[model samples]
Target: MEPPSTCPPDLDGPTIDIVVADPGWHRLIPNAGTIVRRAAHAAGMEGTIVLSSNRVVRGLNGRHRGKNKPTNVLTYEHPAPEIILALGVVRAEAAAQGRRPAHHLAHLVVHGALHLNGEDHDHPGDARRMEMAESRILHRIGVPNPWKRA
Candidate 1:
């Protein structure tokens, strides 16, 4: 898909190179790159987001995070900034939260982009700040706050 001509001017949007490794997910998310780019722009970051399957994300989580489990999203920042979103986890979380899958995906993209930009939740104070930033970014894009209780 082509990039949007009118992105927010305050931030230099990222060149989001997206790779949809899952055919089913490709069909599920039509404009995945656009979503990633907008989220990155909101976070004032530049990166890549790979919309992948559960297995690929699980392997990445295990190798990188040492969790040995599938996760909704993973961010890498050393070699290059990149975010990986697992379709399976995203879909499930969205459903559980009664939110549209696309909205949840966008939230995760923003969360991952923030991580790429040095935002972390390792401590309570840092996590609160990160969550506030995520909420603000998502709100700017008209997405509901993901942290709000149901």
Candidate 2:
């Protein structure tokens, strides 16, 4: 099902819809929607963000990407812009990297939003360009550069 509604007008950017399929996401990061919305706005993207579990994400990944693993974030820009994030994978990645879940979530949203905005990292040059864009967007929201993580 879709979310209750998209982000409010105060953000002053693209419209971002947020769906919290897994309520437990709050336990991992209470302001997941806010973080996502802010990141999406920073990237100047309008889309839907689904906060779901590894099980849900794995199913989608298998059907869509032919991969049978739970990924952190997936972006679809065909019919419309949409981003899905798996709570389990995101939390684990954050812990493994010694970073806050909130920061990681923001970074992922920006990354996915960039994808929706036609950014790809398939080549070295493209990767650098996308990384730089992600860094700038994240910095605007006060998130550190994920690439510079120790």
Candidate 3:
């Protein structure tokens, strides 16, 4: 998802704040705080977080599309004067995909942070770049490569 250009160009703070929300599937996920903080740090962002847990029936991956049902992970950005990362994840979706919710959440947080910095994946090339970057970052933290391209 693209960052919403709601942030004004001028703000007093030189730091970007991180806001995290639990998307309502605690049953499937854990260690949300550490995951979110790690993402913010990986993206070179510093600040407060105002995150929320959400319920997403529509799968953002569209992997199953009109067939299998929604899968985990969604990124929303409120761009600007003070950047905000709106990271959403479907805990159930993660479980259904055989993914750990914490891992999925971390991926989305990083993805959301990238959007705030103008990274996009609408095209194959862009997605590849994003995936590679994600793979590298996750690797640094001892997480397996998250990129399907690899």
Using lDDT as the measure, the top candidate is 2
Whole-model lDDT values for every prediction: 0.80, 0.88, 0.52
Candidate 3 residue spans exceeding 4 A from truth: 1-28, 47-50, 55-89, 148-150
lDDT of 2 by residue, 43-97 (tens): 8988688888899999999999999999999999878889999999999999999
Q: Arrange candidates by lDDT, descending.
A: 2, 1, 3
Worst 10 residues of 3 by lDDT: 1-10
- The best candidate by TM-score is 2
Error of 1 at 47 (Å): 1.8
TM agreement with the true structure for every prediction: 0.85, 0.91, 0.60
Give the TM-score ranking, best first.
Answer: 2, 1, 3
- Give per-model CA RMSD: 4.8, 2.4, 8.2
Whole-model lDDT, model 1? 0.80
